[model samples]
Target chain A: MTSGIRPKRDEETVIAGSCDSENPRRVDGLQLLGEYRGAAYEEPRFLVYRPDGQAVLLTPLLYRVLTHLDGRHSLASVAERVSADHDRAIGPDGVRYLVEQKLEPLGLAVLGAPVEQVPTADPLLSLSARGVLFPARMVRTIARLFAPLHLPAVVAATLGTLLALDLWMFTSGQADAAIRTTVGDPAAMLVGVGLLLVSTLFHECGHAAGCHYGGARPGAIGVGLYVVFPVFYTNVTDAYRLNRAGRLRTDLGGIYFNAVFIVVLGCAYLTSGYAPLLAAAVLVHGQIIQQLMPTLRMDGYYIVADLVGVPNLFGLIGPIVAGLARRGRRGGRHAWRAEINLRPFARRVVIAWVLLVIPFLAGGLAVMLLRAPTYIGIAWRSTAERWTAVEQAFTHGQVATILIDTFATLMLWLPWVGLGFLLARVLQRAVRAGIRAVNRRR
Target chain B: MVEDMTVLEREHVEFLPSREALGGLVNVNIVVPVNLAIAVLGSAALACQNAVGIIR
Candidate 1:
């Protein structure tokens, strides 16, 4: 979800690094998944990871060139083959220019004309400072094992169970009571929060399982630091291969799993009469709500994206905005076409999304910033109070309260910290952009 | 999406992770609501604890 535009620096990193000249060798051991040749794709998208976890989306013609990357093929040879295959005359210069300017900058392919070391994941497409909880092989196995759950009959039944549980809890006052019980009893709170966290992790598994069922291979399961908090994730990049239906399944997979988690929580609550289990179930409902918000870079956004058959709506925000700004001037009516590559219907949907999201996000961020002091005060006060509770619980040898308070304290404080990091990063980008603009102006 | 049949566009839109190909994206569920939930829940905890009186 990064802007593919790199600064004109001679820096040597793949944040947007590209090489001047070299064969269009797929980065050594590139895990780039191509579509099955038998007849699935007249034009399927290619996912090429940059050094950073972000990747660039390729148009089909570009993807064709990418598919030709065996490292042994010369630029001219590839150009020749792709031209003949697609009935398009993309010369060697066109191939080289595409690789050098577009693909190389992103480190999707190497033109190490004097190409230094090729940047493979060296082993994996990865996150920065990642800790793999389950390796790719294990992830594949898990996905395969759990694939049956995505069967339509099973999904419908699971959703039904969640609906029933939700109705029963809210209608019977079980939800309200569960929250009260969970909060009052330290053990209950501990168990409730613990189950919620586990359920979140299981949500990742749902994505893997869905991807597997949709005929796409999933990658490793791991925890990575996102904006300074630990987040569990499953790599379902290959899910892009599936048609819109398949992609939608992958998008909704996490929520489906959350429902499954809720079923288990409901069953536990029912059998053990555990209020906290039900309480945790309630929290899962909240989490599911958050996940469904198309505003954030979460599942809902992807759902919208997959529904429209556009892989990355976030990427379009820039182009569309620029197109709008340019159109305000004379002779810039068609500016949007240069940036947007989607069909009429898809393009319209993306524009609407961009319009909605820009204001919504901007307003939210502005409010948070303007009211930062107030939020910080609340967060600080809450964190201190939670920490105190932790200390008090420790003094009293109340293990469960100690656990609950400590976790609560962490939750209370991390966002402010994350926000701080967010601000700092934004400021850094602003200043860097300023410098780059100045350099360009000169 | 076929190759923009009319034009041999120079660039390919590389698909980044539709989902995190690399792992551990903590659902923003924790990210957004934890701010409010902890306070709300902690109060509930306190309300519940009023009876037990925190003596232990």
Candidate 2:
């Protein structure tokens, strides 16, 4: 009954022979966060981490091994216990190999090794640019305050209220009336924009609250500039420690809060006869749909990812493709199995996602690139029109029109601007990768 | 717990590296640009209203 340990296999981390380290210390901030018995996960997994750093999973036996790496325990000591527990003959050399090759490389253990970040080949469509809005400490405090809102009874009540509101808004002709009132009145339009922003911020809080409710600590809240648009985010990266239900809750929490906001907006509209509030309620439904766009790093993207039990779907593309190539070259056997370490169910889901995603994003980006001139000209013309509208509003002294048109003009051209930034970033990564590949070739 | 007496028992507990289930640096984010969505949707609605003489 010997325990075997290996890092999640990737191109960078190769299985190597026995190592030479005699003593390895756990990194200063490293921690073993305990076992994950989340029912949603296909297997029992262990969690280890450093606050605000990477979260690594380990096997049960490997979790045991990590527990012994206090720098005081000799390689022979760990090997002896593991050998006894595993009922196998693992020598000190074997222990050293596990520590040096597996743990140290992942920033878990160190033996005077220079700390280096593991290189991740992020997917082409990943949202890599981000900045924090609220620090971890503050978000944690705020999230805890909102935790009660997710209590089972409260969640049920909120959902019921949301459902009832939707029914009334559509059936009672409130939604149509609200939209007309909002669009025709310039001030209502500007207020609708403001409400959407506020609702988005509220949505981030939902994620934080969900994480807190799930017995996991949430980090900061922030915004990330995903390829072309600003996306509000709450760093619920800590949610990995939770079970499948908990993780899913974190993923769906944003939209759930949107529901809550809608309910509040509906109530306010009914109470005060506020047209703009009702307008916000209506426009927010669009935000909900947009959030659910299955592509990109949106809430929908994460929902799919959590459902499949895969974190980075894009990262698996290279390995899965390589596995396919190997299958083709090696008589089409179970060679792909060696490439992906997922359970069969998750593996299939991930593969299907890769199939659909690659062409969709590639084709979409291709069209965007190919027709760049036409799109840019259109954007420029639209912006100019809105600008002219703003000038006309000023001449007529229509403050509401000026405000609403001004907001629309700014938003109208941002997506095209985002495309430009996306191109620059992708180029930077490709150039960096190219340089590295060239150096490796030498 | 080293009393695992057989390979079958050991098979279940072999320690291996785990893959994180979240994406990117911050895991998940709501990528919908509220400002943009409301802008486009509002513009189209207003344009329709103008055509039908509501905004005038």
* Best model per TM-score: 2
CAPRI class assigned to model 2: incorrect
TM-score of 1: 0.80
- Tell me the tens digit of each residue's lDDT in model 2 across A1-442: 0112222335433222222455666766666778854422344567776432556566555666677777777878877777676544566766666665566655567665544454222344544456778898999898888888888898999989988889888899888888877766666676786788888888888888888899988877776666655566677767877877888888888888888899999999899998989878987777777677666667787788777766556656677767766665655446456335578888888778878777777776776677667656655666676677667668777676667656565555555666777788778777877987999999
Candidate 1 lDDT, tens digit per residue, A1-442?
Answer: 2453433333444233343445566654345545422122224455555444444556666778878977778988998888888756787877877777666655667776433432322111123344688898998898888889999999889989888888898899988988876777677676776787788878888888989998988888887544434567788877766767887788788888889989988998899897888888888887788778786567888888877777667767878888877876766755456456566777788889999888876776676667667767776787677677767777888887767666666656655565566667667667877998999999
Q: How displaced is residue A397 in candidate 1, in Å? A: 1.5
Q: Runs in model 1 with CA error above 4 Å?
A: A1-27, A30-55, A66-80, A90-96, A103-112, A117-132, A224-230, A328-331, B1-18, B21-38
Model 1: per-residue Cα lDDT at residue A129? 45
lDDT per residue (tens digit) for residues B15-41 in model 2: 222221122211112233333334464
Candidate 2 chain A lowest-lDDT run of ten: A1-10
True-vs-predicted CA distance for residue A305, candidate 2, Å = 2.6
